[model samples]
Target: MKVMVIVRATKSSEAGEMPSEQLLTEMGNFNEELSKAGIFLAAEGLHPSSNGARIRFSGKDRTVTDGPFTETKELIAGFWLWKVSSMQEAIDWVTRCPNPMTEDSDIEIRQVFEFDDFGEALTPELREQEERVQTEVAERNNNAQGIPASKDEDEIRSLAKAWSGSLESKDVDAMLTGYSEDILLYDVKPPYRLKGLEAYRANWEACLPYFPAKMKSEHRDFTVTVDGDVAFAHGLHHVVPIDEESPVGQTWLRITIGYQRTEGEWRVMHEHVSVPFDPMTEKVSYITDEVIAETI
Candidate 1:
């Protein structure tokens, strides 16, 4: 079972007080133990709420609120992601952890949801997407210490092609695998832009189902340019669906991807996808082969 061990914030933590060196050393030793036991997957401490903000939603309206939120006892100061054989095992591990704060602090352990936990909500396709995402995450972690020294345009283009293929498969995880952790995306949809792989993945999850089961994403006029560890590509991509009844039976979209060689792999750092719009009609012009040829 996977669990998240949450360290609840105390008055001192909310006041932006740092942990003492002795406590830090004790915690570091505990972390090392967790690592040796293979129970630790990830762990991190959070900055105080004073530096954070929250977006509250009601209907279609969103309200942004800055923080330095009250209720320090309810806030989380840090957390650890761990995998163990059972909940009891997780409990045992948490009990062994050092007190993370100078004041009275509490730790809450909750099980993390697995793909199988979703049951019927996760179709075979969705399950496959999840698996692909997991594989990509594993690969990224494995390559963390092996960053390549040279640029390879061909390899970069191949990586781009794989990402495009994932779009056709509606494999959100596979598509996201090509992007960096801090990927910036200017999408055709609302919200103007998206930052981070998690946001991009969520965007795909919400959009992919609208596409047909068997779709084909064809790339044309593809161009790739490389400069040292950085590369960029631009292309016209068309989405064709197997079912004629689908709302987007056939549509064209423009795509520009920025890649940076990181950890021996080409990962997308930025992506901008858009459709041209006519100012006169205030409507998008969905380009087709004829339109593309004429524009060229």
Candidate 2:
């Protein structure tokens, strides 16, 4: 859960009073603790209300009011966005925070609403739009901070497609970029599983030459799901030899990929590719009209 801890303004805060050096040091130490615990997302103090203004709306009419108005308790002076297990955890952290003002102050903790909270009201289309908006906001923030923007689901999907395309083109470097240094791959071939990027790349090097010089590959029924820094995608891939004389072609290899965001880049952390086999004969089954119908 995420919560915003708001520091309410006091008379001194509204008057533009700044915290003492000792208080600032104490607050900094507390912030360090929060960061170490991975609970802190963002925190900032606002300028005094004297430098702000508010607009009031009544139907179509609007009225503007200057700040440093009488209600000090109602004004916010600072806030911290935190991720915690529960409201109780938020409260416990808040209790340990240093006083943000020279005088006694009050801090309010409010839970942030998540997409799931909207339930059925958020249609698939709306959900996509929301994700786009979120990506835009994150990119803007990254630009302001001079950090590279992280890849979203669409970008990751493109990367996955490029990886598949590399197999046909035999572009080892491009294919290598799709995976992380610690990637784990479960391929259809022998050895059961391959660990690390070196092993995975070696496997590709040994197999690419066996494929046709002119090859065609397509990803079908692809689906990608992203949640925060982790994501996973699944699809069926069909590979065919472009040459009419070549008999080496396969259809519908089940593929699943897992990705993780590392330093603003999405890299494949895990991959699993397999073909169904008969239990009795231990023979791999290729896709066919009858097989598709049965599966459907």
Candidate 3:
């Protein structure tokens, strides 16, 4: 079970007062303990409502009110996410926590709503989208030394195939259309990193002559892992050369791609390719493992 612990400080508590240095140190130590226990998923402390605002709607009219309002009893100052085996376990942990505010303060612990708890009212698509967003957010937070999020594998795989197909077809115009105006690309080959539509097109044009020449290259073992709006894949290029003696020899190559969702559609953001070496001649080879892995 996952639960949210909201810490609310009364206006009187925060009035002309700040968190003491010793209290700050204690809070840091408490957070470290939570991390070590592996039960802490996320946490944050917010600024006082005195610096916030509220928006309200009455019929057709909307109103915005500045903070420092009189309702101190209803304001929240911070929150923490905890994952435990049961509600009682969470309660036990909370019972052990030191008071977050001076004098007497109240902390509210509420269980997070799980998808299954919604009964049959939640559509699969909506759930999937929610999961994707959560996963992406979690990945980013984890990368930034924060709590983790979830990821979806199927959607990412489908998106990868679509992207690769666009490339193999040389649908340059359509493919480039997917990218943002300020897009950035990273690849293992020439033009190391490219930015903008013009530069990307130039790089593609320079490399067009190296395609399969007969059968188009296919993206194989295309497994995509998506977190929120970002996704990535481990894929392979399967192609037979038109000329036998070409320097870029071999019928297969390894590729990894990273993508970001733009304007509600997935687009390639970064790509990496590696041509392994042949032990016999110490030369680069393209007979990648993805084909073999797929077969297995």
Candidate 4:
């Protein structure tokens, strides 16, 4: 489960009083512990309400209100995003947290709703729009902060190159660096579906004998899309024999990779590799089809 841990504002927090060095150190250590436990996703503290504003809606009309809100206890001073097993688990973790404020404070834990929580109500179109908005929001935030929007795209492109390089060298351990432990892959070969890191490594080992001793990899027409911590890329790939007449010629296989940014690193969680298929021929069609490989 995912949860939002909200730290309620206190009189001192609303006054813009910064935490003492000792308190800050304690909180930092607590956060480090949370991160090491794989529970921390993000944490941030806000400036006092005096630096913020509120917008009120009345039908089509709007009203702007200045802050330093009177309800100090109701306003939030900081928050943390965490992925945990259950509400009780979140509570247990929270109990170990250092005091967020020098004075008395309150922290509220609320479960975040997953997309599946909507059941059948969230249609495909709505999910698409949601994903687009998420991407735009991340881009805009980075732009507003003077950060390059293409940073993640550059990383993903570099990762693609690194992946092909690993494949060319036939190094399963190197290739597994960017993959998740519970990775899932749908391949072009028989027993096409592979799950877990071990199965993926075995798949590579099984096919290595068929590959030429010296090989080169080519990846083309690659495109990447990122939405916050989730990203995906698709491209056409070919493994070429360096001089030996290989059994498998330079066949172009369509490849798609699903990436998740966890603990500040992007890892491939799902992958799909296949050749084009023709319904009329009822066999694997040999072509570099430009259609999208998969959807979010």
Candidate 5:
């Protein structure tokens, strides 16, 4: 259960009747205690309503209502969000809150309705949109704060990093560990779907000599989503041949790899490699601005 505690202090309470300095200090200390106890989700205080305003729109006719209106008792000056096991738990915590005004003041604690509370009224699409919004908000917050990636993300990244290391070491067996036995590797060249583990291994072995000097590969736009025993990773694989300047090596190729969780590890179950397609001709080949201009 989650609850929002709204604190309102009347103008008379703060008109030379502000909460004592001792009480103010205690409020700050109490907030700190709440944070340390891991019960505080968020908390913020707002200046008097004089600094705020409300707008009303009726049939495109706008009306502005400035604050410091005579209804201080109904105004909100501060709020604290708390998540607990039940509404009673939230009420119990709110009961311990210190007086926020010199004269007695009212602090309203209301239980916030959870998504599950909607029951049959909650649509799947609405839940998904809500989740997406929350995910975006969290990502934006992390970007703004420069926080490190989440643990699950870092774990998947570590798998890719280890796979890269194995490729650098030319450890075919270790590299193959990232693929499932039912893997289907598709490339632009012939034998597109390198079906099954044995076939994939054989094809890789045959192609090893062609890439004798080893290959340097990097992934971009990488993302992995895992659910239960299944997981997938799809990204552009940028590869460069170390020795031969052949077709794939000479030109850049983008590859998409799909993975599945075998047991507890991530394994590549499918791969699609290709380059840019000719938009006008619908052909899989490199196209540039010069080519497009010439065609036009």
Candidate 6:
């Protein structure tokens, strides 16, 4: 069962008096115990009611009241969400907690409702809807234990890192193996988009002549995301000519690539690359700080 541990506001809490260091330390220790026991879900301390508001509902009408609500005992200062076997277990855990405030405070434990508790009142359709909503929320929080991916994120990341090897070697065949026959690409150069594998190869072949015979390819601030059969990555690519005097090098050429898992293999489906330019002069700009890694 899930229960909320409500920390009832006291006179001191309502007055916005902070808890002493000793009390804070004790509460921290108690929370650590809960975490180690695998009973902790979430916890938070709220600001004083003076920074809060209340809404009253009657039929279709509503009204709002600003707080420091006078009913200090009825107000909550903070709360924790916990999952335990039963309400009694929640009570036992609460009893073991240290004093949370400078003055006496009442902690209330209220059982959170489970779908089963609604009994037949919750129809199969409503239950399905609720389950779907919960699943979505859990997935967003990375708590959806039942939802598993294809376990190819690492493989995709490996592909990204290996591309530099092909670049440094000027191995067009090796680089082509990473892309699909239907690959689409948008390069920093003209011909806005390249469609199909032939165009992809042609673009590479055209650019290879200008590339340094001996160069170092580096990718920085790279991020890869995989979802089922689809994946994407973006990063700054830096290519340096081995000859210090050579000018055929780039510092922050932005690169974005898309991947698709087909059958049992992953392939590049799309790609986009560009460099930042100054709007006024329409000239390329260099980033001095952490700018190259995070954004376009």
The global C-alpha lDDT for each of the candidates, from Candidate 1 onward, is 0.80, 0.82, 0.68, 0.82, 0.68, 0.80
* Structural similarity to truth (TM-score) of each candidate: 0.49, 0.51, 0.48, 0.48, 0.47, 0.48
- Model 1 has a clash total of 2
The lowest-lDDT stretch of 10 consecutive residues in candidate 5 is: 287-296
Worst ten in a row by lDDT for model 6: 287-296
List pairs with backbone clashes in candidate 3.
135-150, 136-227, 136-228, 138-149
Give the per-residue lDDT of model 1 (tens digit) for 44-116: 9999999998899999999999998997888899999986656766776777788898877899999999988
Segments in model 3 whose C-alpha atoms lie over 4 Å from true places? 144-296
RMSD of 3: 18.8
Query: Model 3, residue 133: displacement in angstroms?
Result: 1.0
Return the clash pairs for model 6, or none: none
Candidate 5: tens digits of C-alpha lDDT, residues 2-46: 689888767754343455689989898778646533357788877
Q: How would you encode candidate 4's per-residue C-alpha lDDT over 1-296 as one tens digit per residue?
A: 68999999999999999999999999997887576444677999999999999999999999999986898888999999987645765887788898898888899999998888998899999988987897798889888999767768767766766766677778888888888999999988878788999999999988888888887565656778999999998867777676688756446778899999999988999999998778998987665323323321
Per-residue lDDT over 149-188 for candidate 3, one digit per residue giving the tens place of the 0 to 100 score: 3334534544444444566566677567555566676655
Per-candidate clashes, comma-separated: 2, 0, 4, 0, 0, 0
- For model 1, the stretches where C-alpha displacement exceeds 4 angstroms are 147-296
Model 1, residue 256: what's the lDDT? 96
Which parts of model 2 have CA positions greater than 4 angstroms off?
150-296
Worst 10 residues of 1 by lDDT: 145-154
Query: Clashing residue pairs, candidate 2?
Result: none
User: Candidate 2's residue-wise lDDT over 55-168, tens digit each?
Assistant: 999999999998767888898999999876567668877988988888889999999998899999999899999999998998899899997674586678668656666766
Candidate 3 yields a Cα-based lDDT of 0.68
